[model samples]
Target: MSATPAGSAGAGDGVYRTGYFETRLAADPNRAVVWRHICDYLRRWIPADSDVLELGAGWCDFANAVAARSVTAMDLDATVLKAAHAGVTAIVGDCTDLSRFGDGSFDCVLASNLLEHLERADAERLLHEARRVLRPGGRLLLIQPNFRLNPKEYFDDYTHVAIYTDRSLTDLLTSLGWHVEHTFARFLPLTMKSRGSRLSFLVPWYLRSPIKPLAGQMLVVASNPAR
Candidate 1:
């Protein structure tokens, strides 16, 4: 979910172009391996039989790798449909308005490197919408760049408009009726483009390591409380 300049084409203007995907985020087999490990780590919060929905699922990496009963990947980029793995349902739509999905339609909602692409208001709306589509006790998982940790490079991606630290993100989720379950301020490297991310085999070890080096991304897990 990259930001388009004002008066530019609708969603996916600045980003989501075929060139952006081909160049900025080139297809890498190693990325799939990284996502596989990430999905395994995330599985603790996401049951194997859970129905999952990934918002702004760029490349559908998590959607394709995660073990789930059902997986739906939604992004403004049409390329998502092509990136989706077999059995993964891909749709191009605005994440802020998930009206296409019924209330409590998902057991878990995942968003990675997405919220910052939206304006503050839209980010909040997306969060609320995510909550609406999640079943009671369902979880919302997020992996986002922590501005507090990477302030110098936080805005390196021109699409990033909103800033959030672990503290701020937890506060926002709690204010929106979510019970935050976990927060790791320094979970992963700031970007997949980082040199460290190239070491795919080391990712699983990194996830377990207490002393993470070059970590700038934050992971937040929140659950919907019973009504």
Candidate 2:
């Protein structure tokens, strides 16, 4: 994540900038569930020392967590980037045309709750761009809402335009020349493990706890074969 001139191209005109929870969920337990899922997804694949690129990174909460190397957080809204977490090198750009980067530019790519927002064709394009920028054998970790878990739960988010399943995502990656490594059916439960990790360090009793399963989010980790 090196610094470069921040360009405003394709940072669409506010379509992707809406405050998600503020407009819809109103800060409830479900929103908390969503956050937990996001954090869990981050904790699962993102080690503290990896160079990460977060696509469609809305406010950079997860981007802020990368401890391995710096995070290049990109979104289409400069205003959203402005409000992003402090350490992120926020870039206002689109993932569809990641021409600014050369091949294998990042160790990992993190995309949370973003794929369904695009039409099916655009989603495929996004995955192709992701493959192009990732290093050989590097990973792409995605956390997407499962359409099976009540369409309104995911569709309620204004940007959602497509639905997803782990199998469908796996097929998509295969079509783009990537290999699937693992898939988790739930998001909130994984989050609990991550939160448990933090707490175990605080009160050792939590270290012995078992994770609870709440199947609402799908986490997919895929790899581009080493070149």
lDDT of 1 by residue, 1-227 (tens): 73342444665553566545665676777788899999999989999999999998878889999999999999887778789999999988888889999999999999999988787888888999989999999999999999989899988776677899999999999999999999999999987664655788899899999988888999999999988
Clashing pairs in 2: 48-67, 48-68, 49-68, 50-68
Predicted structure 2, TM vs. truth: 0.75
- Would you give me the overall lDDT of model 1? 0.87
RMSD of 1: 1.8
TM-score per model over all chains: 0.94, 0.75
Steric clash pairs (candidate 1): none
Ten residues in a row with the worst lDDT in model 2?
Answer: 1-10
Error of 2 at 205 (Å): 12
Segments in model 1 whose C-alpha atoms lie over 4 Å from true places: 2-6, 11-15
